[model samples]
Target chain A: MNVIVCVKQIPDPALPGALDGATNTLKRDGKLILDDSDAYGVEMALQLVDAAGGGEVSIISMAPNGETAGMRTALAMGAAKGILVSDPALQGSDALTTAKVLAAAAQRLGGADLIIAATESSDGYTGTVPEQMAEVLGLPSVTFAKKVKIDGGVLKADRQTEEGYDEVECALPALISVTAGVVEPRYPSFKGIMAAKSKPVEEVTASDLGVTPAGWAGAGQKVMLVAQAEARQAGEIVEDDGESFGKIVAFLENLKVI
Target chain B: MAINSVWVFAQVTNGAATTGTLELLTKARSLSPNVTAVLGGDASGVAAQLGEFGATKVYATGDLAGKLPGVAVAGAMKAIIDGGDKPDLILFPQNYEGRDVLARLSVKLNKSVLTNSIDVAVDGDSVNATTPIFGGNTLVTTTFTGEGPYLVAFRPKSFAAEASGGAPAAIAAASVPDLGATGGAKVTAVHVEESTGPKLDEANIVVSGGRGLGEADKYAMIEELAKLLKGAPGASRAIVDAGWVPYSYQVGQTGKVVKPSVYIAAGISGATQHMVGMKGAKNIIAINKDKEAPIFGIADLGIVGDVHKVLPKLIEALKGR
Candidate 1:
């Protein structure tokens, strides 16, 4: 019941984000932090492994500058170790390329009953990499899982849909993408943080996994131009004056929604 | 290299073509007269309707038999393409099933994909896609530099779905190929959450609440007001992430993208991500106490007020009417 969770170390999303002028991709050279979205996956994996009673959770991430700060956060939260794939050639890689690298790294780790990831990263938000990784690894994928459970070597997931939810099932050696709020992520304890500083984190390159990254040059897709989106004009602003609700009623009446 | 055929991954719900599928079909027809619909479920029920929307042929897998449609459908399309019946372009909706199929297909074909696009343009032999990034504040134009068939996933409501009044499309049988270990996942059961009123995405009017509502109990005001207006209640990512509501009620970049006739944001100081989902509404009304809230930038009418005071009064006024 060894579980591997895919985590992403991204630039802090609280501040404004900028695109690199040279590569036309989001600038990533800044200090990276753990994407809040991936915390759910790490938490879910930890709980599942704990429930299974005899397994370990490992973190796998691909970030530039050999970033380990984000991975260390997950390690402090109780993951056994981590594998970081960082290489200059990996910059500007598309979603599929990232999927290939991650899938190859998962195979390199080997012997995992399950692999988990966030439905999408907060910064990049491609929302396609997990399923693509499933395709590349030739594994079954159950995405948008709000609830997951293990029963007799089978994985049962409550997959969120537009209407409601579908109970999906698959065997081991599968990938699952979890939605946010699926589980509560625990804060790293002081003892855990001290232990994480000495934990093992293997650093590798894309080539180390036998992956030739289809970077911006080979991805077959290019960002031609980036421009500001059209701005919508501001309308009237009125003080509440204890009667602002009347204006809304009049506005909706004008639109016939009343 | 010449544009000739365009294919759409037509999604069906309740034995009928989805509105998103019809929108893709309409856009595909404009790109090429030879529009084909690739349906994973029983296409017999919606083949004619697909044709009326401009599909000349429907390459359909009769039934998936409970297997995950993404694996089998992607396998079937890969087989069809391997059989040398490839189209120049393919369109899919940026949704669960669509993303699943397109991602699998991209890996199977070793092709690239452009997703979350809001518009597509044709220039000579190339197709360009426009995607809004940074929470719809910035637009990025992208195009494939490799061979066809190019894959692109567009957001729902990106285009208007209009029927061309054409004849029934010819149905072609497409069998799901052997999926190996990837076909292990299956839907065991479905549980539809009990929800009242119109769907958030399809409703003519939408009322959304945010963190300004103070706590979970106050969300009832949003629901009550929405009910009085005969609309759907929505929530910002903040509230949804805080466990105040289900993700289905979320309206944001990572959630549902809704384009309603009138959108009301109460106690919502709009984050750019939240604005991305509801900016397309024909009319936007923002009710927040903070006059400098970013949501007022695009709001059709900005009311400076408190939700606790204003929401109750608004609900009373609407109920009286």
Candidate 2:
């Protein structure tokens, strides 16, 4: 069995002012780490390989050349090999174009028994790429899966639903999008970190996968405008005192709380 | 081209329709007179209700067992695309299932999709959508430049449901294709964690406790207040990390995002991540000892007092009501 996991490098959303002051876009400063949700996908892929007892796991990512750091981190997690589809022209491509590039890479890699990805990227939170990739690759896809298991060459998993959950079973050569609760991603061990340096990482250009700049990125969709984000104003704070407490009661009553 | 028709996916669960489905139909009705509501599952009775929400035609697709909603939605989208009469736009609710289906359908159609849209308007041969970003701290207006159907998923509870007051329309049963992998993955079993508080994501009112509660046991006070108002219980990342509450109850950038009718913060200092989750709430009330707590910045009402004393009083006031 062969498993392929698609990972993305995203900025840490916890930090403040990580936005580019000029473009009002997210600034990819600090360390570019593998998306937290994608880590679970990689972990699930590794688990599947382990369950099969001696299979291969490959990690693929489409990012700028500098994003090799994220691919290295995935390699350190236990993937057999890594592939980076990097080019300077791929910057600012929307989800549709990104899916096209990933689909092309998957085809070039000869496809896999199973493909996994994060439910959504933290930066854009679009949550569209994996499903789009499935569509482009002409494969069935499932999103927000909590647990995945394989049996008799068939893939069975539980995906989180709004009200409850739905059980889905698909044949091999499918795509699955996982969320955080699916599995606790493993931290790279000292041995794994050292071994990652020796692991083979293949670098391929977008053209190598038959992705044309005009069709893939140049014809990409564009957002005509982005409205400015408004800041909320401070509210009136009432001190806790006998008189103020009475006023608070009155306020709640006016708001129909009391 | 003159706008002719619009389609909205009406989500149904346990024989009942969701509010977001009705809201989508209402919005779609504003765009074109030939509005259709597509519903899946054994919930075909919802087709008539779609007419009350201004759907001129209700397309009822019966349930396909073991098929996940993603497959069903994609099939429905294909039906609209191949149904001989094409629609100008397709609308879906921005819930978990809707988001998943729209993402897949957009890819299948090779079209651009706008999720979590707050508003939609039609211009000459184009449509504009508005959505909040950076956790509702900022809003962005975007438009697509393609000629295909523009897919949009609107946020739940964002639009008010309007009455159509018309007779039921003729229901059209759409043939749901047996696209393999409806249930792409099967669940052998399910184990739900025992929980008492309201689900933070689905709650209309939320009362959150923070580290200012001082001790893990003191959370009982916050829970007590939440119960009185029949609201959901939430916590800041600090308290969750400290083991006072489960991570599922945490409200922040890393946690659940809720836009309830009213949000109450008790003893929280209001970190940016925490604020981003609940900032879209209609009304915000904060109770903290420090007057300068950042939670007060976005709060509509603030009380400077010890949570230990304030929470109990608030409960009493709610009980008195």
Candidate 3:
């Protein structure tokens, strides 16, 4: 079984990111690193490949400036190879357009038995790419998966929902988006890190994957304006007068929450 | 400059409309005069509530029985729209099930989806949804460039759920198309993690812990405090990411969006992702040792103290310590 995992190289989200006022886009000129959210997907893909007797785990990422730093992390974790899709035309791409490029990349790879992705990107957080990719690929998609297993050519998962959990099973050649904590991500060993440096990384442009700018350029929706979010009004700050707990209790009581 | 009709993919759980669905329906009322609910399973139990929230008509796909319902819902709705009986705008809750249905619908309809919308407003005949990007640093107002049956998903609790004194909607049966061999990923079994008290999203007061809790074991204090206050226990993305808690406990942009009446942040530094989920809280009380934590900016009450010390004390104080 072969698996493809989608990832993104994002500016460190721990630090604040700036917007290009002129373009109203996130400034991506800063140093980028592997988004932590993608790690679970990578880990899930690796484990799935390992459990399937012998298989390869490949990564598909769309990065600015042709950044492979993030994808390298997954490669270091034992993924066989990586593909980076970068192009200026791809800049400011919306969720569906990005999914188109990814699906096209999957086609270039001659397709895979399955594709996996994070439930949502830590940066974009749109939570639509996986489903969109599934649509483009014309495959079944099980999202928010907490547990995934493959047996007898059947892909089964415990998909998470607001109510609780649902047990879902689908045939191979499907797509899945795993939530964080689906599995504990393993640390890349030093040996694995050294081996990753030699792993071949394939680079391609959007058109190289047969994605024409005109096809996705004018996304169905357009971002009209971006403004600083209004700050939630500050209410009160209190010091521990050896009775701060009491004050909170009183506050909650006053609000009738208790 | 008016939307002819609005459709909400109403979510029903245990024979009632989820608060988030009702909330979306409530907001949908303001956006369009003709509001309809596109629901799954029998709408009989939830029809009254959906109506009370301003649903004029209920379009249900009957009962899905065991299928996940999303695929069939999308297929059914696609048939409806293709039949030229399309709503001007469609709204869905930003949930696992909701995203699945809407995303598939986006493909089936050859449209795109606008998700994580914080708010929506009318501009001429177009409906623009405000979505916070850069982890809530900036808000971008987006609207479709062309065509009808626009798809948009609003975050849970983005709008308040209120009754409009409307009569029960006229419930109509909708056909569920045949789900293929995959069977919408057949649900085989279900396991509900046992816990006491109300659900986190529905709770009036929510107490969430962050990485400051040190370890998974310390989350007990959070459950304790939530119990004392009769609230629900929630966790920041930090702890949930660190494997300290289940994703179900996560409250944030990427997780569950909550807007309880009172939200207490214990040891949470309040990352933008986490803040997006609960910032709508009527009152926010943050407890963290770092006085400079960004959470203080939005906190209705900021308590500068370590969770290790503050939580136990608060729990003990409530226990008459």
lDDT of each model, Cα atoms only? 0.92, 0.75, 0.84
DockQ of each: 0.81, 0.44, 0.65
Cα error of candidate 1 at position B274, Å:
1.1
TM-score of chain B of each: 0.97, 0.81, 0.92
- Give the alpha carbon lDDT tens digit for every residue of A1-258 in model 1: 799999999999877789999888999989999999999999999999999999899989999999999999999999999899999998888898999999988988884899999989988888999999999999998999999999999999999987899999998889999999999899999998999999999999988999987776878798988999988999999989999999999999999878
Sorting all predicted structures by TM-score, with the top scorer first, yields: 1, 3, 2
lDDT for each residue of candidate 2 in A1-258, tens digit (9 for 90 to 100): 889999988766555534455544556756777876688889999999999987788888887655778877888999988778887676666677788888887777788999999877777776678888887887877777767998899888877665555676777789998866576678999999899999987888878888764432343244556666778777678887733445555665676754
lDDT of 3 by residue, B211-300 (tens): 888889999999989998889999998898788888889998887777789999998998888988888889999998888888998998
| Residue-by-residue lDDT tens digits, candidate 2, B45-111 | 7656777888877776676555566667677768757878677788988766787678777866768
Question: In candidate 3, how many Å is residue B303 off?
Answer: 2.3
Best by TM-score: 1
Report the C-alpha lDDT of model 3 over A1-258, residue by residue, as the tens digit: 899999889899988877776666677878888889889988999888889988899999988788888888899988999889988888877777888889898888778989999888877777888987887787877888988999899998998876578888888789999988888888899998989899988999988998875333457787788778876787788766666887788888899766
Clashes of 2: 13
Per-prediction interface RMSD in Å: 1.2, 4.1, 2.2
What number of clashing residue pairs does each candidate have, in the order they appear?
0, 13, 1
True contacts kept of 1: 0.85
